[model samples]
Target: MQESKWWKNAVVYQIYPRSFKDSNGDGIGDLQGIIRKLDYLKELGVDAIWLSPVCRSPQDDNGYDISDYRDIDSMFGSLKDMEELIKEAEERNIRIIMDLVLNHSSDEHLWFIEARKSRENPYHDYYVWRDGTEGLPPNDMRACFGGSAWEWVPELSQYYFHQFSVKQPDLNWENPKLRQEIYDMILWWMEKGVGGFRLDVIDQIAKEPDLKITNNGPRLHEYIRELSKETFRKGDLITVGEAWGANTELAKLYSNPDGSEFSMVFQFEHINLDQQPDKEKWDLAPLDFLKLKQVFAKWQRELYRTGWNSLFWNNHDLPRIVSRWGNDKEYREKSAKMLATLLHGMQGTPYIYQGEELGMTNAEFEIEDYRDIETLNVYHERLEKGYQKEDILNSIHAKGRDNARTPMQWDDSPNAGFSEGTPWIRVNGNYREINAKQEMADKGSVFHYYKKLIGLRKTYEVFADGKFELLLEEDKDIFAYTRTSEGEKLLIICNFHEKEVPFLLPEGWSGKEEILIANYNEIAETEKLRPYEARIYRKA
Candidate 1:
């Protein structure tokens, strides 16, 4: 029999601490800021919070590069503050999940600092290193952030491998000593009472730079299984890996029923539909509604009873869903609710980004307004290739990471109530109308709609263990599906476009249905769905 998992039915909220709230007026959100807002999250009704990295770092990649695994960064808070945050959250019945960047560490880390001093240092084997060929890098492989993947050391006369920024050196997982160190660090955090971990860039850990392989390496699962046996299996923990290269076949190995690896993974196949194949994310392509529906249906069916899924639309590294897939201007509230219904009605754990529940829209940023490292690198790289500045700006507006990093809009006050002083990043211009304070007061707002959607997941048994079947597989405008369990059925229909679309009830699914939740207040009994309309019906 399959074992039950707490995270299976729980709704997780992802908080990017730097942008969530500022408590000390230092323009950056800190641990105390999150503590002050614990009541707010408790009222939102999330079961867990997945926080991005808050460990000690040089902020080269905005905290992904960890300099110390045992200590919290001074910028965020001390160890006591983190302990207090965890204790306070537990009192509110909410679990805390930390982000673990195991693939690399900051160059300033003591191990890396020692390893770079000399090739014969005791910590030299902690990182990947190679001898230069003809005074050049061992290979022509480029880094993910637009540079050589190997950085030369003048004193050592060798190159250290880095899949991301030069300041972030890739760790050598083949070393059992290094792996044990990582395991011990994870256990230390577990001892601190963390509920789980979100492994960052986990798929690239077993990479072979010499063979030009970056993801899904030969020993990938072997490493993951070993890591699981060493740490997570010791506790009832939830582990979700960020695997951009995963498909249904690989997903089974990562999140199989045997509990060998992770509980689930964050896949990007659906998120990549709008980008050109085998190209950078900035290479744009029109999103096909049919293709999007087909991808979701495939995962929902393939993972049923065999593994699990993680349903989400927005995160710290992507654009807002309302801006990317829905009409962010006129129908922001309606479209946001529609997208929420589509995701929450699925068979998986749903994650809500910090500002997403309030129907946050993308920022209208100019070149000077951008602060993300990836965005600035892409902008300069495209400009050097003769691409028009206007075109690059448009792409950034559509797909930049900064779109999701803007301060959370708590109210209409200056800086969106995120900070008393100047914000590190500019707030979205529509905060006056879309802030959370305004939504919580209005019953029909997106914030309340999200609350209802979350409540439905907790109340319905079919949502956690039901058979999923796509309703309108060939329909271009209406994305519909059904979930059935123990003779109870849920019909969920969503209009993908900004125009009214005809929705026909499947045979034997009409007249006996009760409206569970909807974005529009008055859903007509007629066959037409208004612009960005979404509705869920329950029948026994």
Candidate 2:
């Protein structure tokens, strides 16, 4: 049997600081705002909090482009505030997980500034640079934000590569000095008592741009292993890598039993089901429920004991789960709870995005209301491609990252109680009906349902170490599975649509079962589940 780890069963709550809460009416959420909410997170029962970037930045890529790794941005707060937050959260038994963006740095970073000065500068090799052929870039490779990936720097008479925005230059992992600096920075944070880290775009760090290779590079595992030995291996920390290109085979190398790379990787195979396989994310396609089942089941079964998995449906870069997969209109609460049950029942560490517990739906934003860089870039790119404004808007409404960046709904007050002043981003208009204050006051709210799910994971070992087996694989409207561990068997059934569905017990399963948890108040023994209903049963 594999040895136990704290993060194996722990629940992580991801907080996008800018939208969580504002302190001192700054119109932006800060470390102090998170410190103020530690008690609330404790009540919600999350074991750790994954805070997005708070480092010094120019707001390019929303802090992913770090200007300085050693200081907090003034827009959020001071370094003292971060220290206090770490201490306060520790007192509440909640560990802080920092978002580490090691793949790139802001163009304003000291090293980048120095690198652009001249070719003979010691810092010139700190970033990926190549001599342009004739007058154009080395190749026509496109940036993630829609232009040529290579940007011209006249001072050096060369081009620097950036996988993302031009302002965020990719760091050269081939530089040993840069790697040492990163290791030292990580150790500095760990010494300050952070519980873990979430590596941003980690898989792309060893990218071979010259060969047109972006992720899962040839030296990827070698670099990751070196990183583990130099930093993560030194402490009992939980590390999750954002590997959009990782598959089942590659995931094993990342989260193998030896723990040489990371604790687990955040794979997008399941999330990309609704996207056209050969096209960009903006290209819409109906989600294939069967394919979704296959993706989840394959990962769950393959990584059962060989590696680990990170379970999550909502995050800062994606649309709300309730709005994307479930019926967010009339069956909002029911579908939210149903989706939570389906994911939490799997064997992995669950992540709950801020306000996700409140059943927060996607924002109804106009073109002018969008603030995310990716969203705006795609909107304009689609328009330039001659796509209709309505079609582009509809796709943005369905898949825009801004949908997840709206201010958190705290209460039915001015600005959703997120800020006393105008918010940096527009608040979701439905905050009056779906806010934390209102949900916490009602026992039947989605907030309480999520609280129960978090508690169940801690109380039941089956949820952590159980073997997962998908049931009713061909059923279009029902996602059903069974988890078994140490003579304990749990049958989880979820009705995914807005219609009644009959769930017949699989062969060898007896009718004498105890209801562990259910979304509906009354569940009839007739095996007929109502719209968006979820039930977990244990054989009695």
Candidate 3:
């Protein structure tokens, strides 16, 4: 069975290390802080933890810019602390998954340092470098953070390609020697007992003949196959690739049945529903429910037989799903539960981002209070291009990465119990009512609801191996689907709106249905669904 794999039945929790918790009063989260929370995660019912980058870095892009792949940064803790954390997590039966960034490295990395020295340096070919166009950059391609993708170096009389910030130069995967280095580093981590890796922007590793095209380069699958053969295939490791612009066909190739590359891939189509057409991510608009349903249906049906899917709404980079997709102000709890039910009921692995289980809302921080470099850079650029400050701030509120990066709310104490001192970033103001301490104390809160949802995934084999079929495909206000495996079939219905809606059961589906789960205290006794209500039923 495709879903029989260890990770397919596992509910993964993503932890943004810098914002999870702070130990030693540094006001920044650390390895020891994660150790302190292992029991909490275990209690929450997550089987694996995927940590954002924690390797040695200059922190230019919030730890994505790695300088040393072998050691932990002093900001997080020493390598010994990481080892201890891993051991502690294992004791709790939770696997640890490190975020691996193979596409690029910090400009301060030793390899990049040597590569920038001169053409004669052996490491010069470690990164993508080309001669300058009469002092101008080699191409007009824009990096993810904005500005030209190429940076010139006078010492080498050449420009280096950087797909992200200028501080993060793209690595040359064409160099077999560099690939060997990456493989060795991954093997070292696996030897330390890391259960798996979450590859960051993995699809961006291979570019076309020129540096302009963004994702899904020509040799992308070749590089992934080699990496998988050398690293992941050596063990029962779970690897997921973050393919930002990848569609179903490309996703299948990266995560095919042959186990050539990754166990699954994170696709961005559904999440980009609210992004304005012909505009950047900051240009916010309402999500089209029809389009959202179509994207999910397409991925579920296309990837069912050969590949796997990584189901997630909130992550380190995107804004909180409740705020972006649901009503954050009025129906926060209900909408959060609805979103969770819809996600977990799908035939894929579910990922819970930090604070998501507590139904944490987005931070309504003013532009000045935001800490994410991408948010600030985008804001300033848009303002310079004649966008009003208020409009830009509103857009930032709707789509800024800081919405998901705010300090995790543990309690109602100072800094929401995230830090004793001033936090690296501002904590959300509503933590007093939405913190985990409060939610865990209330059995009916979002925390306990998420626990139940996760438990269902482990208890029911159908959730893992069943074939997905979308129901009421044209319904915009409600999302309904069914999963059938063998003689068992489950019907999941979710009200995506804040108003009640009447839903009729599909034809040829008349039978005594057992209520498997629901967001409310009890399943509704009528055909009408409550606002933001969700229910799962199993047919005998």
Candidate 4:
């Protein structure tokens, strides 16, 4: 591995522009506020920041559906503000990665507008469109947001394809010319000194040529490999795919040097603790622990050969892992710290979302309080489908990933000090006690643990790119893995449960030990991890 590349062993902090900070006091966050807080990010000890999206968008999907690729939305600051932010972040040794939503464009995009205008229009071929056979969209595929994947374009009298919201139409990548358009835009931003892009829904981007879809179809990788060769070359950029269905073999194909595509791929399978991989098929029962241990162990062992995994517990799109995976009522704090220990101490690059450092969790919200377009749409769709109102509400409570996207907590003041006025969305009620201002002051706080964890990655070379070997995988609720490099080994042991557990160190591996990092209530030795406490034992 190249030691100089900024992306390697780097920790990424994701910022949702609308919820990060508000300078205008309009109850919405903008660029100038982020500029003022550069030092704050620096203190968090992250290598880079990835803003959700700041482009011109209808925000129906809250900036996921881009109307203009090059222009900055007015809600965010101007293009000049972005340029300045880049310069400011560079000064702090912090790189900025952008969210590249290339899978689709907003219905209002000029290209989409023209495409809908007439069948003979040149822009008509920019998106996927097909002739309707019998007053129905030509396929059985369901949209991610819960409806038909096809929407009728009355102006052109044809059906356009969209894997997500109908307002966001999928681009035709099979058209080589369209592929070039995306590549050109990528280079356009790279020229601006932007570091890289997190490709949204990469697995969904490349579908089969025959357009066969029943949940998931085969031949997905064939198209992705072809697309990778055409767009992402060997050098000049780093591409991280939001790949959902990638197995270890495919991961290696995309992440390895000869893999042709990107640096790493985000497989959410490990994070889907209680989730049914397919949404159309929701399993109401709670997750089985033995099943989870097997799942993660299999992934850790299998994916090691081909590609690097993207480790994370919370992001803009999912509910907090603590509340979902960990027993929130019984073991909130230990569970949070245990989850962190499991993720950060792993072999791959870890991404810590803005409030995740403080062990921030899902916001308690009434069904009516949700502002997420997708959640509301799902509720309505389920209701219209004759599902019980109670069942729909329960699904929202359990499966609503938007709960994690709520605004960050900066202070105990109103709106968590996010703004002087009402926020675009309500802040989590626990913000008063859980804000960054408070965590920075407290010694044993979760925020402090994050700072120490980040420092460990930078200070210890082994923790960053070290070899991870899964040990004691059979133990339920205890995730023990060894990371070693240069003949030195460090064992990371964590008890995921609130109850205490004992562990036996490997035989013939005795050495002088130093505690590099721990997440326990009171500090303890490496022989046994207390409750949610995790200890990293260093060899001397």
Model 1 ranges off by over 4 Å: 1-4
For 99-149, candidate 4 gives per-residue lDDT tens digits of 988778999999998888898888888888888854677867778777888
RMSD to native, candidate 1: 1.6
Q: What is the lDDT of every predicted structure here?
A: 0.92, 0.91, 0.89, 0.76
Model 1 lDDT vs. the true structure? 0.92
lDDT over C-alpha atoms for residue 156 of model 2: 70
lDDT per residue as tens, model 1, 5-65:
9888899999999999999999999999999999989888999999999999999888999
Question: Cα deviation of 81 in candidate 2 (Å)?
Answer: 0.5
Superposition TM-score, candidate 4 onto the true structure: 0.91
Candidate 2 least-lDDT 10 residues: 1-10
TM-score against truth, every candidate:
0.97, 0.97, 0.97, 0.91
Considering summed lDDT, which 10 consecutive residues are worst modelled in model 4? 208-217
Residue pairs in clash, model 2: none
Predicted candidate 2 versus true structure: per-residue lDDT over 205-310, tens digit per residue = 9989989998888999999999998998888889999998888899999998787888998998888899888998889998899998989999999999998999
lDDT of 4: 0.76
Q: Assess the local accuracy of residue 225 in candidate 1 as a C-alpha lDDT between 0 and 100.
A: 94
Error of 2 at 27 (Å): 1.2
* lDDT of candidate model 2 versus the reference: 0.91
Per-prediction CA RMSD (Å): 1.6, 1.8, 1.8, 3.1
